[model samples]
Target chain A: MKYLKNAATLTFDPDRCTGCRRCVEVCPHCVFEMHDGKARITDKDRCMECGACALNCEFGAISVGSGVGCAAAIIRSMITGGEPTCDCGAASSGAKTTDCC
Target chain B: MINLSSVKKKEDCCCTPQKNKNFLARTPEITGQAVKSLSNITRERPEWVTGILNTRSGLVPIVTTEWTRTDRIGQIRSRLGGYRMNYSVRPGLYAVGAPDSSSDVFISANYKLSFDILRRALRGISGWILVLDTRGINVWCAAGKGTFGTDELARRILGVNLAGLVSHRRIIVPQLGAAGVRASVIKKQTGFHVHFGPVDAKDIQAYIRAGYHATPEMREIGFTILRRLVLVPIELNQALRKSAAAALVILIIFGLQPSGILFKSAWTGGRPFLLFCLISIITGAAITPILLPFIPVRSFALKGWLAGAAAMAPLVTLTPLGGTSALLDAAALIFFPLMSSYLALQFTGSTTFTTISGVKKELRIWLPVYIAGLAISIVIIILYKLQSWRII
Candidate 1:
């Protein structure tokens, strides 16, 4: 959190959460908890933004900006001017973007 | 029952083909059912995957102690072959030693390096190694990728018939893999207790001997000089691969400068830019990684720019051919720093420091500036090279 002084992008709503406990299961950081059958943000700062919980959440109840934190992915996104997942400048093959200029 | 077709076949392995000699050697204790179950799993096979052991609980895939030529080569390739190099073993419950139902079941990713380290550490110890399908990613990265998550772990346990094999209910997982795996959910759904071990595999033996309590040293992750240096090769290799074509193109373009596109002008004109590019690549990839912890900057890009500047200082000071063109000098000044910054930014994902949001935020703020700088320099250099514009 030294460099990332901003808040964790994770947001959870009890009403939206089905209490399936998927987020609690998928989150290695233990950032979320189960209380009264709803997922609760126990330690928001512990969240490393891996996006595992968000991807595994079936109910669309969980919302977190992708926490891939992949520097290559981020650099690729900037180079391509497209989704961060694309491999523009990345070593892998992906759709090359003309926006490198 | 899980659709395992998504897992790759042994023939599809990317490493050089070794006569299609795909086979798993089983110990005498291995049950026919266990052997069949293991052979059914067709993923990237590690050379250490021996066969099965008839443990008290059920069946566990046996990992060989004798490190083979494949492991030796795989280790070297993984070190120098960049982040994309994935030598994964099939995901299953593996036996590290003479394990039984009562032995500890440690879970890890399918990345062979991680698997090898775990098996190596538990040399004399008898235990179970439950490898999750992580698409050949390491434990930490796979956790981030969700391939080592609750679902996959649960699925693997069930798929391997782990309940029938082990008497213990607790599963020891890597601390770094906790991001993707939720202990509460596993306990709730699979009824298997999840226990996170120390962050490093080298400390696992000590951690286990100490009854699962981790020292602060075990818990801490350091960006040591040696660790930084090892990653340099892969980064350097990747940069060279991507830039070689560009280097050739630039050499030809610069050769186009003079009527003789021969060695005469090649040395005089084209070679200078190529040297600039190679220097940029080496400085960005090699020097930056080596000096990562020592670089006096908060941002990775800034650190890289500084490294490039440091590299360029000696080159500019030592060389005497500066009076020929102001454009090349200007290009070198701007381009090297830009390249270094871009390359250094790539390491953000791999480093222990820096957060995802932090990188994203940095990209939002600084990327435009770097790209703009690169664009302007390239434009000016190209214009000068074409003789359309001169520095007034």
Candidate 2:
């Protein structure tokens, strides 16, 4: 969670959150805080941008581009133009990749 | 009675005690003049039905299915000159048509998924698919275990009279099955070629379109987000419902009880307990997965414990006025994290990042701590309850 604030990799659009709180719930670092019935990343610094929030959002509120903190997946995705699954933002063919990101 | 002796033993088979009790009982026997009770099963095979029938040496022993049965069993039997079909292959193959010089022959496991995927992929292609009996498992896993290996593939090809059925010498197989199957040995034994296709069903269309050439990307294995996410629904539904119901009961118990605790001002309602339980649930099921990777610790259990500890912050500030509250806090601090960690640990089955050794190591290192934490929490809870009795 401490790595997320400055990472700027993930951005939260409160309008789309729907108050699901999945981000708040899934964040390992307690990066997200719900206030006045909306989700906010209060501990932005702690966010590793794992994209667990984005993946489970069910809404497009959370976006983290190709950078979700895993370096290998990103590298592979760049090489293959595939969507990255693990932290290394490699391009994977589909939303599924062997990587944890 | 049909003489099964005409059916040659495909290869090495040991009639151990257990094998006799199982497979021996199923072999068609001629004891009395038992009527061939043709079940009035008048249902015509659906268009999707490629084939189906009972198999030998299996728990159910039925291999034929309407899904794969393109024609009737009698037609198949007569077409093969009335040669008795060996039921030993649980997932067997049927070479349906006469072969021309370029007729392509494909190979697949008997696993329903493998069969369906391959056949569905080959839809209009006028080729043959040779299915191997892999005991109701997929090609990748079965191949890994040697069920779809060279010996079985070669033997099945021969047993089904494949040599006569096809003019072409090649047998295309899914690339994933290569782990167990020895291509060189299969080629030597059957004199048929083995061409490995892409690792996924979706890529089969492209492979066939590309003249049976598998691009390197097509052959690669993918555990993409979609694939990983599909597994979450069942687990989430089960965990959420069970934990919610349990948490509600615990909250009610904390609010009520002691024959008259509700009447005292020192004790509030179940709000606090409910809040704590909610925190635990969110952390256990929803949060653990969301923050799986960056939870600080390498061990999943530890990651959960850390999340639990962070969640306990509010409870620390809302300390109960009574000494019992101290004990209750300690108990909660211990139990909630243990519960969260345990749930997170179960996610290993769905995650690809962890090795078996890593999981074992985590369990060995953390299980004792989890158990101890839970034990302490329960003891403290009981002690707190008893201490509150005096104040009441």
TM-score of each: 0.75, 0.51
Docking class of 2: incorrect
Q: Write the per-residue lDDT of candidate 2 for residues A1-101, one digit (tens) a residue.
A: 12212434568898887886545543434557789888887755444433445644667888753222233333455579875334211122223223221
Please list the residue runs of candidate 2 whose C-alpha ends up more than 4 Å from where it truly belongs after superposition: A1-101, B1-47, B50-90, B94-101, B109-111, B141-155, B179-193, B208-213, B237-299, B302-326
Report how far off residue B302 is in candidate 1 (Å).
0.6
Sequence-dependent TM-score of model 1: 0.75
lDDT of 1 by residue, B303-383 (tens): 788888777756755686344666777777787777877777776666664567878877886688787887988787777
What interface RMSD does every candidate have?
6.7, 17.6
Superposition-based RMSD of candidate 1 using all C-alpha atoms, in angstroms: 9.0
lDDT of 1 at B121: 77
Candidate 1: residue A79 lDDT (0-100): 75
Residue-level lDDT tens digits of model 2 in B1-392: 11122212221222222324444324345111111211111133234433222122111111222334533442244223212122122344433232243667678876545565565666544555677876544565455446667788889877765665556677777766665565656778889866666767667768878987766566444445555444445335545666767665565556555775353332354556566766776676557767666577666677777887777755555555223476766766777777777666656544433333344456667767877886787678667667767752
Q: Given candidate 1, what's the lDDT at residue B8?
A: 26
